[model samples]
Target: METVAITPLDTAAGAEQSHDPLRRQQAVVALGRRAVAAPDSEILLHDAAALIADMVGTDRFLVAESDPNGGQLTLQLVTRQRYGGNKPLVHHVALDGAQSLAGYVLQVGHPVAAEHLAADRRFQDRFLSRHGIQSALAVPLCLPHRSFGALAACSSHERIFDAGDLLFAETVAHVVTTAVARCRVEQALATERRLSAGMLQTVGAIVLVLDARGQIVHINEACQRLTGFSLDEIRRRPVWDVLPVAEELDLFKSIFDGLRHGLGPVQFESCLLTKHSERRRVAWTYNTVCDAQGEIESILATGIDITEQQKRQQPEETPDANTPAGNPPSEPEERNRQHPNAADSRKVPVRRPSPINVERRSRPRRSYPYRQSIAPVQDGELPDPAEFYQVQCNDIAAGGFSFLSPRPPESASIVVALGTPPSLTYLHAQIAHVTRMRKEGKWVYLVGCSYTGRAFY
Candidate 1:
């Protein structure tokens, strides 16, 4: 039997040659080598089928793969010369276990060779007649310890594919099985790496990585925008050197201590020194990012700017009127009255009522409580001590009245005129509740004096 590699035949001749034995085994080995050397499975399938077709003088080839569970075979690639043109047609058939040569190969592990399928009775001929195929060859593509389906070649002519063709087809089939398995593994690994990178890029919060010496090692896009500094410039720069010296040293110490003690996600407020020469108060959450061996590789931090928040929480200071322009002022009038002096007593003396009048006023009488009233305070003006008014009284509690004053006075001294307002004004009076006024808008300062021999209301 002549080898297909050296057989002499017409270019268009095709007839069943199943009984013809293999003559050029070396040529079939070369085809298997080419399939393995191809970069991917698709190329391996295409070249493997083409090589066998050339040696057998056949025109159609179908490469199939076995299912992972060993229950079925899948037709992966099919090649044919359509309309006898120079361009060949390739079809990717779907995997089906019902109506194809791949399905038959999966059920029967041996090869199938048919010469004139329309008359052959050993195999199902109806499927071959439907596809206009007259002769066919199906060889199993097997790997070590696994079956990877079969290679099926057919011809439109009455006869083709001999023993030598099936041998070459089986060799290429084995190589395609190995190539497909390897490609699937590499692709899965590449997909996992891409997904990991995508997750890191979209992580929430401003991620900043700093080295042990307080130098920036890495920063995400959010951190870069917040600090107004390019990552390149901030990298390897100390954190404290960037901030102002006025801040407390305890804040920096706490940050480093928390990181060193294996504490997770420490939170604290501090000032962030910006590239534009501005200091921004910020609250930071930090954690130590460690390597696979549990050693700290860098410090990971998240920061929130709180300068405006701190300013809003502070209270305003009270102003003074005694100071000249550009100089710090002295205390106000209310504060000055808290101190005592001899001249204050020489200004106003205590007031006393007659004993006979006090006895008559104290006589029992059923009547409504006497309504005491306070005077209104002058706007933007402090009251003079000399303007205080009084009436003679024995029941001092009922004599208590209200007076209007803005911002309660710091202190009050009750002076008694022993005889009369103009003549005995130089006498001194007993002191009363110093500052019992409610502190609010233009309110009254209520002062009650202790007049020992005074009359009742």
Candidate 2:
């Protein structure tokens, strides 16, 4: 609990007047700055101990970190001075038990002042005598909320440490603690980041990370495999520049705007274009990566390419008038016996509606509310067949709704909502084609609609 006082040294003589203590303090501060700025941890610990030893004019300094199992303190970073006639102090320590100064410091939270090292009854003096050590100081290097290690400073002079010296030593101890803590945090973060990146790359899903300006910061290996683009080609490029899908670009833009407005998480899906110049359909969920102040820093995007899955469910094959029916027509006599007055009685054998058509006409369109209350409606209005049916909806963009009118005429009108009520609606959609589901017992025909209607939002 001892506080170190800062003793201002007179710099009147400039460089010549600078002592080891002053130079060492400068080194300590410099190391602290480096620790703060360092992108990695290993150098931080090594530099911090060296700086501490230099500042205190110590023959040697050893930084020992406590083992996770609480067994003993292990020497992490060590510093020894170069003497004129003697060998440099060894940096190694044998710390299998509570015997060394480092071990004692870890065991007792209080700083150890080995001022009377030679004659102390409880202390062994051989190590001190061998190194000509008359004085030693060990301060526990404790993190803000965790106790881990100690900083030991040793000298060859007896009773050399004073209140001022103790204060300075403790300050140096704090510096070491800060550096060590920062390094530990950085290592942990790096590990977590690596694991996360690995998961995104290997989990069989397309993942992407975009920066503030909507450029690709990172895309996982899976994304590359799915899209056929190299990392170098995509980096810092606008997402749409690579995959030019206006719908997807707009979706990404909305998500970015939501995050910027402090929305926590947003999810949507749209048609995507890939690096191979192939069109893809995908579902994406985005989470905003925030800074310490809860401001948006970057975007974390996780997605799955469902283009194939969707294609399989809804094939491009359209139902044509000349296409054969699921059930073949019986022989001429059998057909007449079943329906004597059928339309085919004419010499020209007028075309007859297929059984699929008869069944479809019988099933009335159920106008039940489609997720009315809890979910948003398309463009907040119903589809009008005449003018332009605008499917206005902000919700359910991932899987859009399709009109299930069994017999879709060639030019039926359709509408889709494009924005909030009183907002402009996407209109003038043309019916592309009518495709029937081939799966057994599924009889609804999908009227493919295109937005001849311009983009409103």
Lowest summed lDDT window (length 10), candidate 1 = 316-325
lDDT (tens digit, per residue) of candidate 1 on 38-77: 4555455555555555556665655666556775544533
Q: For residue 94, what is the lDDT in candidate 2?
A: 48
TM-score of 1: 0.34
Off by over 4 Å in 1: 1-23, 64-98, 119-128, 142-149, 160-162, 193-457
TM-score of each: 0.34, 0.35
